[model samples]
Target: MLHYSRTCGTFTGMKANGTDVRPWLAALVIGVTGIAFGACDRRGADDEQVAAVEVAASWRSIAEGVRGDRIRRDAEMLADDAMAGREAGTEGFDLAASFVAERFAALGLAPLSDGSYLQEVELFWTRLLPESARITLQAGDTEIDLTIREDFVRSGGFGPGEERVDAEVVFAGHGIAAPEYEHDDFAGIDPAGVILVVLSGAPPHFETDLRAYYSSSTVKQTEAASRGALGLLVVRTPVDQRRRPWDRYLPGVGRTDMEWVDSGGVPFGGYPELAGSAVLSQGAAERLFELAGRDLSELFVHHGAGETGSFPLGVSAVLERSSDQGRTVSANVVGILAGDDPRLRDEYVVYTAHLDHLGTLDDGDDQIHNGFYDNAVGVATLLEVARAMTKLPVPPRRSILFVALTAEEKGLLGSSFFAQNPPVPIERIVANLNIDMPFLGFPIGDVEAFGVEHSTLRSSVEKAAHAAGIVLSPDSMPERVRFVRSDQFSFVQRGIPALNLKPGSISTDDSFDGPAMLADFLDNHYHRSSDAGDQPFSESGAERFARTALLTGLWVASDKDRPSWNEGDFFGEKFATGRVAPVSAP
Candidate 1:
């Protein structure tokens, strides 16, 4: 029996619970299970090192085996041309479901819920058309009238009931409220019902990462609703700057660049630094700003930021007025691998990866963003994990489930639905190990355990990594916002610990080849057609990744106790200090 003890909330369990039982026992299990699995090789390495050469040596072969044979096979099939763009609620998303279902069948994986694998998610499509959008910003006698689409792109204004609505535009400088910063955009102004025209993104007026403030359509939606406005019209500011141009794109959960998302090729999502707010052509934006007696820089710096004020944007629009608003139904694929241990099996370990991306583009490029690297790799590796485990020396003690969510790119819709209305009671879940863009390059060194800051799941990740001789990436990338960016956030919201593991990164301030390689992509292939190609396979990296994950699954699967959050982390506090999970206010 394994002996275990907990110190500072960290659990320690050796093959014999730290006793000399291991000395007399023959090394049979180590040879068969530990050594063959890379368990011995990666025992200890400094934080500064990348490849746990000795550690990697332990599991390289099996990890590579899982990657090359199993993971690659599944990836190829799922990313096949037949799946189309796999847009949420589309025929393609459904087709991909069958493909995944069939793969599960082939792998001999069992159903997770009531012996049935499918979990239907209901989705609604809202299309909007702009009947009227007349906004004129005037300085004295000069009035500038702006039309829609040609001058700006408006997805129908979200408001209660109305055949049509229009409100005068008011320049409500940054619509933000941060008490710590002593800033208040709505301090003295109340532009209710009218269109609240605020500058999109932060300007020089703010300190801190600008991308965190206004990088998505959500902030606009959130603020508009919060301020009790009829609609929100965001004015673009030239103040935005990023390391690269495409950095402006919100690699939002399932979002892709070329209309459709191809998961197989993309790298991890860094916050879009470039200007992501709606870009109104130069001429049109200037005309509107001129009315406020502000030029590009001044308005962006002083008048831009935040989502408050009673300014009406004089904005009216609809969603599907264009040909692109077609609708379809998609699903959330759920599969289960039953645990052999009755008690542990009742406690579930959740696995999730987004399966939707930008469908297709207009330039006659019918190619789907198969999302191979973006998430297909995560999903594929997950499938491979299921395969390896089901063939385990003995079935795991806990249940392992697979979920491929839809519309992650469209604001994490499917996962949100799951989080909101879980098929099983949410509390029964132990932890969620989410997979996303796994193949930027095999982690030559340590894996980036993204939410390592959040939960005890991080400890499981690190221990498994250490057993394999790999170190966890050095620190939390608060700027990277890994917690809020992935579907893991949803699970975290419900009090289940979530772990997001990066394939692994090398040490040296960064990986030796990482920076140059990323610069190359950001400059050239980041979102171009060049990303999709049949390149020579390097088994070393893939094996390292799978083996590490295999160990994590095994560790989490074997233990009777479910993983929890570390006490100090934000998510941990929410659960421990407050028995009830916190949610968006009513």
Candidate 2:
């Protein structure tokens, strides 16, 4: 497995196998795994002016120093020239990997496998012909036919051979069976032997907060799989550009593959139809909704995705699609750090961040969507921690793993891959602290952990953040379904308690001056081009941010027991026992 140790201020690769892989690491050399939190907080007199972490000076100073020349150098090297748009398998991305490997080498990190730093992820890019879709409706002699692309899209779902069918349609409104909302879209339908037609996402026409109900693919995909249907179709009215559908197929782009998992085992029909998740056109969707006595013309206002609510419609439609689809291989970078206490070291603590981002957009723009803010920063943090942890006073009691994942943007693919294909046993991992956009400094408040309140890590988080003087952000907007959107979601799906750490929304007390800065940051750079160094960052601020990350990681790393998931998440039922696999020492 990949290995990392801090020497000086960076990580270097090392190996210490045959050491207790579980139950508190035994041979953890004390000085080898020391950590340094917030150097700005150092009380000594000889330290340089922390730059006060104030205005641009403060932000720039800390950012530059902590990030050091390496960050800038690596950013340039890892990021493509024109952003080569690092699409998987593209020569440009291979170059990008080379750059990361070089940095890992310079940082003292070692390849988990042999001498080669390249993880070599494999995948298939099946760019479909614009004409890959075909659908027709037969309500009467009207015989209405829909156009492709604009009207409807045929996302390749069938694997290998073509998946074409001529069957009656069923309108499963919302395609949801959420007992929490007291709604069952498939209340009285047998989707078997028929093509199940349902709306793909939450209804844009709904009159309430549609964020929760419509944000995740689980509604359309999971519920659809439960019912025995030959195929499934999601009625499409509009698409979210920020959330593209094609990112699912790229290498190191969707999910990591090292964990123990059954790829695609998540049957799509939470209902009972073994169908693929594809979007259906509005006109074609209307034909099926008409069966339920709903009027499309009455609700759809072409003025702009139209004003609608986020509710599920029980209308169904007829669908037919076929394509030559295939499976691909991706990897999650995994490495083990041995701890001192032989008994405690075996308990594992997994630190993860998805390395994949929206690869090349190819709208023919001269720039690449390098995903600088989306998560390259998080990956960088993982690298930094690897270095810091190596400097620990000695190996801690528990083993720490640094996992650079793929496909997290594509529904936590890399993490999911590892969950099913773990290098060790799944039961060994005790807790997971996942990072995303760590550098996107939050408002002056405690860490706003998405799922912490629902897991065993809640108290631990509060204690740790308090020690660091971090104000915990409450679940003020729980309806956003923030818990299900990141890489930690995969571990949570496996019943492992995990937490996603981020700065408070934004604060006025600090450099950026709080609320306004936070808002602009989120709306503008959270996933955009400006997230790069273009937005000034103080070296002190960077240090504070890095320190908080470094400190929190230490707290978690020292824990003896695995964290537990709370009782409320949708995926909680998967784990009958409330524990994840314990960690092991290298």
Best by TM-score: 1
lDDT minimum window of 10 residues, candidate 2: 23-32
lDDT of 2 by residue, 464-544 (tens): 444333445675445445666788877876777788876564442344554466556666555444555455433333333
Model 2: CA > 4 A from native: 1-76, 98-125, 179-182, 199-215, 235-277, 280-292, 296-330, 438-446, 467-469, 475-479, 508-541, 567-571, 576-586
**TM-score quality measure for candidate 2:** 0.71
Q: How accurate is candidate 2 locally (lDDT)?
A: 0.51
What is the C-alpha lDDT profile of model 1 across 1-586, one tens digit per residue?
1111112111123333543422112112232234233323334322222222332233333433465556666666666656655667667777777877777777677765566566665443433344343344445466556555456544322222123444455556655655545656666666555555666554344432233434444555555556665555565555433332322332221122211111342211211121112335446766665555456565554454533443333333221122113323566777778777865676678788887655553323434566566666667777776666666545667778778877776667667667666777777677788876665453344567666665666656776655444556643344444555678766876777777776543522232364444445435543333334242223455555666677676667656466766766555665445433422111
Candidate 2: give its CA RMSD in angstroms.
10.6
Q: How many clashing residue pairs appear in each of the predictions shown?
A: 51, 112
TM-scores across all candidates?
Answer: 0.72, 0.71
Return the TM-score for candidate 1, rounded to 2 decimals: 0.72
